[model samples]
Target: MQTLSRWENTPTFFPQFRAALLEHVGSSATVVVIGASDGRLVLPLAAAGHRVIAIERDPVALQGGLVQLPDGTEAHAAGLVERLQQEQLDDRVDIVESDFLDADLPLAARYDAVWTSCSWHYSANHHRPLADFVTRMQDLVRIDGLFGAEFMMPVTARHYLSEHYTSPERLGPYFTDGWNIQLTLRTGQFTELPHIGQPHPHVHRMGALLATRTSSVTTERA
Candidate 1:
């Protein structure tokens, strides 16, 4: 795992990923950001005019990032209640800080779309149990809501031995779903990181998927 300091400073690689999400979400939507480390995506979501509920388990990081945001950011520090308070969002976005497994699905809140990027790999129980996590992720979205995620492909021992590193796939089962996969396209040569004092070989293969929930599940209780 990359150090928090390093991960915090590193630039976002998949810029198009964010754009795709914004386009899918539309305007004046409510968004929930789970595993929001340092509010990287939250800022953009809010800036796009979405009432964002940013969820993070690490209080230090959450507080630190929230403090940096300008007023009217509408962030929920450690719970889902703040998400439930936004009245303008109609089946739009709702951020929750609870573990996905522990989240109460029967609550009054729901989202028109749900998005998780490069963060689902850290699911407490689903890290190794990829299939289970995918099912849980599917449950979070309202029928036809969008689900987007990026994960590392599994690596082989021989390949790891040669490469001296592991890819996202090797970490676990976050990539086994039946959704259509889009290969990430990158241009330009690799650049080294001066801070790390090494050639930062930009090596990673990412898969982006969008699925429309076909089930009849409604956002509100009957």
Candidate 2:
């Protein structure tokens, strides 16, 4: 793995996601990663022959900045673009430097797979409904393409009040008809160590879903 100083020590699925992608899609599929922060998922996919459309909004995660690590030491971090260039994987990825939902993406530019990891639970995303976020991401996947997301399930009291923090079963209705659900996984509430963005211990429950879009279903869009 090409290490990004800021993102170092962040526990992320590296080759596992790649392995899953290979099992579902053929080699060299085009994948759109919804929260491609600091090249964590993007670089690995790119290295494994997948062309990536990485959408990110955070300048610190996208560009670069000084930050404290998970281990409590401050270090200047390499931006996603810079890291891509360094790893020579820049050509394999198209970076959308804007909020995922607000980014100007043509509907025709669908991908083989659309993915997000722990996105949308942030207060920044509270402005939009959870359905809006899922619809937008799912819309980007071509027929028979994969839709994958690892999301934070409700933990705190306020989390239960909001629809954004959800579980795999709770998110099932969004897939509608003709979508084959391939996977649904969840992790029990667990404590996460302090990291750059999160400077203190935090408890969280996470859930993931991987489904395939077999055919289109007409629905009202927000």
Candidate 3:
């Protein structure tokens, strides 16, 4: 596990990932940002004219800058929200301080795109099955909506390793049911990030996936 501080400060493949997401979802679309600790993705989406719902569980991140969601949950990310306010983007951005897996999100708020950046594995850590996690993610998207995620997984599987860490190739089967997988790449470089139990940086293999929901089991309102 890693702290929210690590997520906020660490540099990853964010620049390129952001560009790809924007291109796929287009401007002025409704977007749901999972694990939006500091509005990195939310600020950009709102700035580009999209209405964004940013979800983060860390209440500490909500300090200084706070916003109330429709359900009355308060979310904070002082620096980023302040920048959005300076750009006059408050009206288009909704911040929710809730756990993505368990939050009782409004079904009517189905989004055009659901994006999680390097934080999706938190579900597996919480004991949720990977299949169920994938299902929950796809449920948030409307028909033909986009889903994108970038996560770190183990390169070589070990018996003692936590189930939360999986091979990059293992992610493929989960997206096949009703998804049009657009991009699936296992990165070549070993990655390092701060971990809770380790004094040194934890290293792992990285993976990125982008898929589109081709069919919806439930009705969605546009």
Task: Tell me the TM-score of each prediction against the true structure.
Answer: 0.55, 0.91, 0.74
Ranking by lDDT: 2, 3, 1
Q: Which candidate model has the greater TM-score, 1 or 2?
A: 2
In order, how many clashes per candidate? 9, 0, 1
Tell me the tens digit of each residue's lDDT in model 1 across 139-158: 56564455555543324344
After TM-score superposition, the amount by which residue 50's alpha carbon in candidate 3 deviates from its true location, in angstroms, is: 1.6
What's the residue-level lDDT of 133 in candidate 2? 90
Q: Is candidate 2 or candidate 3 better by lDDT?
A: 2
lDDT for every model?
Answer: 0.46, 0.82, 0.66
lDDT, candidate 2, residue 152? Answer: 89
> Which model is ahead, 1 or 2, in terms of lDDT?
2
Residue-wise lDDT of candidate 3 within 109-166, one digit each (tens)? 6788888777755543446655655567778988778877777675555612644555
Compared with the true structure, the alpha-carbon lDDT of candidate 3 equals 0.66
State the TM-score for model 1: 0.55
Question: Per-residue CA lDDT of candidate 2, range 1-222, in tens?
Answer: 656545565544344455567887868899999988898888888888989999999898888888876677888888898899899999999999999888998888778998888888988899988988998988888887888888889988899998889988888887767588888888788888777778888998888888888887743443
Instruction: Tell me, by TM-score, which candidate is best.
Output: 2
